[model samples]
Target: MGQDQDTLSVVALCQSERVLWMPDGSPHSPRFKDRYRSRSGGLAQAMTVFLAGAGLPVGWRGRNRFSVLETGFGLGLNFLCTWAAWEADPQRCERLQFASVEAFPVSAADLVRSARNAGPEDQPECSIALRLPVLAEQLAQVWQGLSPGIHQWRFAGGRVQLTLAVGEVQATLQDLDCQADAVYLDGFSPALNPQMWSAQTLHLVAQHCRPGATLATYTVARSVRERLRQLGFSVEKCPGLPPKRDRLQAVLRP
Candidate 1:
């Protein structure tokens, strides 16, 4: 026997705080009983922490091209929400490109399953959840097989494209040539996933950011803030979503 082979699929579990989570593995979000994100931060993470932190739903209103780079794709809640927002905006950017890196790619079936277990309509985050099934179904139909390189998926007549780098964070981001307008930092906690939040990883992301690029994350760690500032970002501590004190948002200072 060489090594133990592990199979991947979407599984639901309950966290200590009563949040819902898919199985903790290569690319899925960590555990939170019912929330789409890790138990540490729920919808609050996406809306108040990530979105508000980056000044989204307001940042790329009239731009010609708007590109977002993300560290972990997870269940794709952030991507879906961003897409919905763009669709709803009359003066949205001309092209929306979201590029992300993931170590493991969940099966298409799991993606659809996640949509069913996601939140309802009234919630801000739920708007993305509701559309998950439709997108997931489409993705499932087209998801042939993922190799360890950049794979692009287009939707809405080429207005939107998701470029997924199916590999480790550092190398994957290094191989990408995108100049991001915004960054969504949705990796697991620094404590649990050091590689995702490591200085090296952040530096790679910062290198690809345009002069006025914005970044948002649910973490306010001193090290993270310092690193971002050193990378030419003006960091800010903003009011966080519930159950947490604060989140971090930053902009590249030309």
Candidate 2:
């Protein structure tokens, strides 16, 4: 209904099928369908759609520094999952930097409530939620301190740097100095969230990618695949999670 400092309020159109609202603040995905507005892609969706699609865990094994850029920090599910994977992996990259952009941010209490509701079966999910003592508290404390620019938060001995870009998608992406090794495209679907998936936005993301950079999302729209191709990404269709037949994955080709 409205916008917050870092969380954008989006109405869930499909609840039975678990489709949440679309993502708005990032370009990694042309259109991010909630599939369950309440939880916004839940744990399975994120693990299958973005993480598996991008070839993570395995992808982060050897690199010294691994950077993941995401749009829509909703509930911080994707972020927590990614971080847990990194922490659990012995071969994980030495430095893990996760940068996400969101226009409306919810309160830390809300995040905790969401995670608790998500349940214990969601191991990494609940684990990350419970383990978030200092960082999560800091996030809650500074929820209202967000302004229209880049805000950096360091955690886990400063190895994890979360940069919140607080503005419109295009403007924020333009202002960030991020060259991502992996991009998590979690925007609302193009039909409902056009601005996030516009061709121009993809181009901007491409500009920030070094050759061979990878991108993944849960959308298989023709326009999205074509746009990514136009931006120098080699696109492919892969098996999606339950219900969805195919999702898109692309690699930046020099």
Q: Report the C-alpha lDDT of model 2 over 87-179, residue by residue, as the tens digit.
A: 767888888888877654555665544444443353654554454343445456655555557888776677767777866677789998898
Off by over 4 Å in 2: 1-41, 119-142
Provide the lDDT at 190 for model 1: 76
Per residue, candidate 1 scores C-alpha lDDT tens digits across 1-254 of: 11111111211111111123446421243332123464443334566676667777788788888999999876666776677667767888898999998765655666556555445435646555566677767766766576667889998789998898876688789999799989988777776667788899999999999999999987898989999998899999887765667888899998
> Residue 78 lDDT in model 1?
72
Which has the greatest TM-score?
1
True-structure RMSD, every candidate: 6.2, 7.0
Best by lDDT: 1
| Residue-level lDDT for 7 in candidate 2 | 29
Give each model a TM-score. 0.82, 0.79
- Judged by lDDT against the true structure, how good is candidate 2? 0.67
